[model samples]
Target: MSLPVVTPGETDTYEDPLDLINEIDELKKEKDASIMAHFYVDGDIQDVADYTGDSLKLARDCTQVTTGTIVFAGVHFMGESAKIMNPAKRVLIPDMLAGCSLADSCPADQLQVFQEQLRAEGRKFDTVAYINTTAAVKSLCDWIVTSGNAAEIIDRVPKDREILFVPDQHLGRYLMEVSGRKMILWPGSCMVHEVFSIQGLVRAKRNNPGSVVIAHPECPQNILEITDFIGGTEKMRQHVMSVKEPTTFLVATESAMIHAFQKSAPQHNFIPVPGIIASTGETCACNRCPHMARNTLQKVRDCLKNESPEIEWRDYFQQARAVLDKSLLK
Candidate 1:
């Protein structure tokens, strides 16, 4: 497999960064709107966002904001999660089709049947839906969990109760390993997270001098063996931030995160790691989720200006929001 181009990234401003920041500020004053962006978004959107974070922070942050409109600058699942939390607030995203592959993999129809099957067996589960799933799926859940706080929130349930964790089998297995709880995990995974390879990463370490490896726990077990650090997006961000030495690190999650990583710790080095290869003559490398790329400045402006892109989940979804409400109190 060919090695991917990873870099100790740097930002280049277009015209002036101040002008864009000022425009967003002016818009905020006039419209009383808040822009929430994902770390994977382009630097301009990140710069303009009132808050930039992963799913956990994004959901929690929007719930706390008093704004009338929330312009979500990320994929479909994110915008839906925001709306699920802030139903009274007007929620919009730059792109309506900004869907997640992981969410797409677990359609509501199939999950509903799966739930019914569990019920048929005289079993009831305290459903813990991963934030990576669709709002429709979240509606079926008792509580929503993000990578940032899944384990903590899982412990909130009665230890004897059964759980059905949806949308990422690897993450579900990881949870089982750490939490020691048996969950009916749905067979789903993000293509990006599914690609990391342990052998390929070892080869990368040997080729790139002074390269430290970092990873997200959603990765398959083999790739995880080579990583120096493993955690959520914020944890990874903090890892680089707390380091004093100027060291190079190879990130094994989504490559887009490198932009934020370098921004926070400019002096430290960051490289994107390619995914592993399998015996089927396929190399797990150079994969980017198409949905996350849907966000752009122009679309964000349109959504906020018109407020036409409204979101709604089924009644069950809205009803399931009680679990999220309870989580907020925690």
Candidate 2:
């Protein structure tokens, strides 16, 4: 069965967003469902969510959910992770089409073929996958890492074994620099992160003097080079909250994350670093993930109320769960 696609601006149909929020709350109670929202989603969804965090935190949070159903208000990979961790519970994403570019970059079959090719060449390596992957890809991985715990997991890798990091070369490169361990990185990157213009970033920094730059490792090396701090969504929030004085921050991650920053530290100012179409050099608010935007309050309510687009458990999910347990749970 095909799920419904949330067209652009479908959310604007809601005459009163508060009414939608109330409807979602009622649906949650009626359906015995818990909503897990990522920091990158719109603030309305986060405010109504039962749990809100980055991928690593959300994975762990879902394991502790007592509800019979999970309505993931993030991208498709997040819904898959929730289902993998809690196979007993029904997992549904607001929009099944809401998928991560990083996950889409490395399909399971392609990754398998690449791994086999490496093995044939007598390259001994452990497959370390970033959490932004499909369940099928996760099943084939030796270890799964999120931005929050990636460095620690990398440090835990045996010194003798080579590491094959899949999906998100920018993150892989950053890991290499931080961990001092060279990795065979798959040439994949987040579309949003990849577009952040170095020119726009420099301009934002200059315009807002004394503004601290907080960037996600998923950004290109050029952007990371000039940033004042580098961390994941949750870590970025922590860093900003630690600052005692009022300050402006130029965020080099998804623009929606600024919502969380404002909520956490209302005294501070947050601005998204604009992105540019590499070919045209025209600046845009391209830092927001289109996938994340696919999720809407209407879709969330509809998914919970209907419960038709549930994430079915696959046989390979058992294998994925084992790695998720080891990497995120530990």
Candidate 3:
């Protein structure tokens, strides 16, 4: 069943944020539910979540959830993922409208058409999709990967078969460089990551001397080129935590990601690299994903309390589940 979209502003009825938190806590117990939040969500939602992490971490962590209901405080694809993993439990998302641009870029039908075209030319290829894709898209893929595990999974693919990496061209390009694997890349990118300004990054570095720039691979080559360290969200956290000395980090991913970084290593300073509007060349805070911001404390409480907008098991999920198990579980 399709879920009704809930906006962040729609859940602003609560007078006290503390009261909403308490209500959500109480509702979780009453409904036998667990909330799994993505790190990209607001800090308040993350604080209230039973589990919080990057996509790969959350995908593995949700499988271990014993709750009767799972409220995913992220985007729609995440809700679908949780449901695919735990078909026995009910999976609910705070906002159905919280969609990923990367996922939307590669529709399942378009992928199928492209694969057919490649096959007609006698090209043998295996599809490797980022976990940000829809379940339908996942079913079409031979392997699923997140930024954290893409390199490892890419290594596992047979050397003979051509690789078709979808839905994030920047990441696909980066993987090709690191793994030395040539891939037919689907031209897609994360809306947030693609917008980060190279000019802003240079300015930030100049302003904060000795500050290290850590970027996600999803970022364009220009951004990743100037970065000191490049990795996924979990890896970024590990990189920062490993440094014993107090340091400033210019983060070149989603701005909300800085919340997790700050919480994990409060002693260190973290700055978000500003994005630029290409039309105007003005610096803006476009690094924050609008979809991730759609999830709110009020919506979490409402979803848990109502439990109407739940993710239903799909026939295609069985196919996707096999890929997820092979790609993520091992």
Candidate 4:
């Protein structure tokens, strides 16, 4: 789906980001809008957010907030999740086109067809969807898993049940390895996480001796195998906070995370691992998620001022929310 292109507000054009930031704050109060940002987005967006967190935490925050409208500085799925949980509240994404590669990798129709094929083969199918999936995909799955709680959730599933994990092959592989559970994995990967070069990573580690490697589960096994710790964004934040000795971290995730860490934990040094081919075919050697980067301070001000690109509620969203509520309540 093509998202609406939002430019700067006509009447409230700002000379700089600070000016835009001031307008955004005033607009949020005037419109009764609360902003929720994802950790992987620009730090400027994060700073203006009422709350900033990882996927699972952000979804929970969406449910708890009492605002009339929600402006999410994240991907399409993240905004959809907010709308799903809070059907009555208006939810708007800063950039409508901000999409996740992992979410796009698994289309809902294809996933439904795959499930049907498995059922026809006389198999009992239980599926776990990564939160990065669309509302339609979540509705089709038996349970949802985030990188932080995936292993814990998977361990609780009965050993007799056959499990299928979707939309993130790397995380699925990691879960299977840790839980000793054999399951079918969907062939999907995050474009940002797929770019880590083992050779370059080794060189980075060698250059900075005594540096600890913290990787996201979305990363390939080769990267995960050499990591000192692996978890979600929240866990990485916690690990960084708890370090007593001075430490330098080799972060194997999006470059935005390094910015977040630097702001919160200024004492620590962070070096993001470069992509195999650093050119990005357009920019410098920066490892950033293009989709997440689509959201800018200008877009945030424009979205809040106009509220033009609100998420449309659908029947399937209710079904997806039911699935999530059932698992979460259990």
- The digit string of per-residue lDDT tens for model 4 on 8-51 reads 66233334878978999999999999999998888888999999
- Model 1, 188-291: lDDT tens digits are 98877887766678877998888888888888877776678888888899899999899989888887788789889998888788764445745555545557
TM-score of 3: 0.96
Question: How far off is residue 130 in model 2, in Å?
Answer: 0.3
User: Per-model C-alpha lDDT, please?
Assistant: 0.78, 0.90, 0.91, 0.87
Candidate 1, residue 319: CA error in Å? 1.7
Better of 1 and 3 by TM-score: 3
Tens-digit lDDT string for candidate 3 (124-155): 99999999999999999999999999999999
Per-candidate clashes come to 3, 0, 0, 0
Using lDDT as the measure, name the better of candidate 1 and candidate 2: 2
Q: How close is candidate 1 to the true structure, as a TM-score?
A: 0.86
| Candidate number achieving the greatest lDDT relative to the actual structure | 3
lDDT, candidate 4, residue 166? Answer: 97
| Candidate 2 local Cα displacement, residue 304, angstroms | 1.2
Q: Kindly provide the TM-score of model 4 when superposed on the true structure, using C-alpha atoms.
A: 0.93
Return the clash pairs for model 4, or none.
none
Query: Order of all candidates by lDDT, from best down to worst?
Result: 3, 2, 4, 1
lDDT of 2 at 133: 93
Candidate 1: where is the Cα deviation over 4 Å? 1-25, 276-287
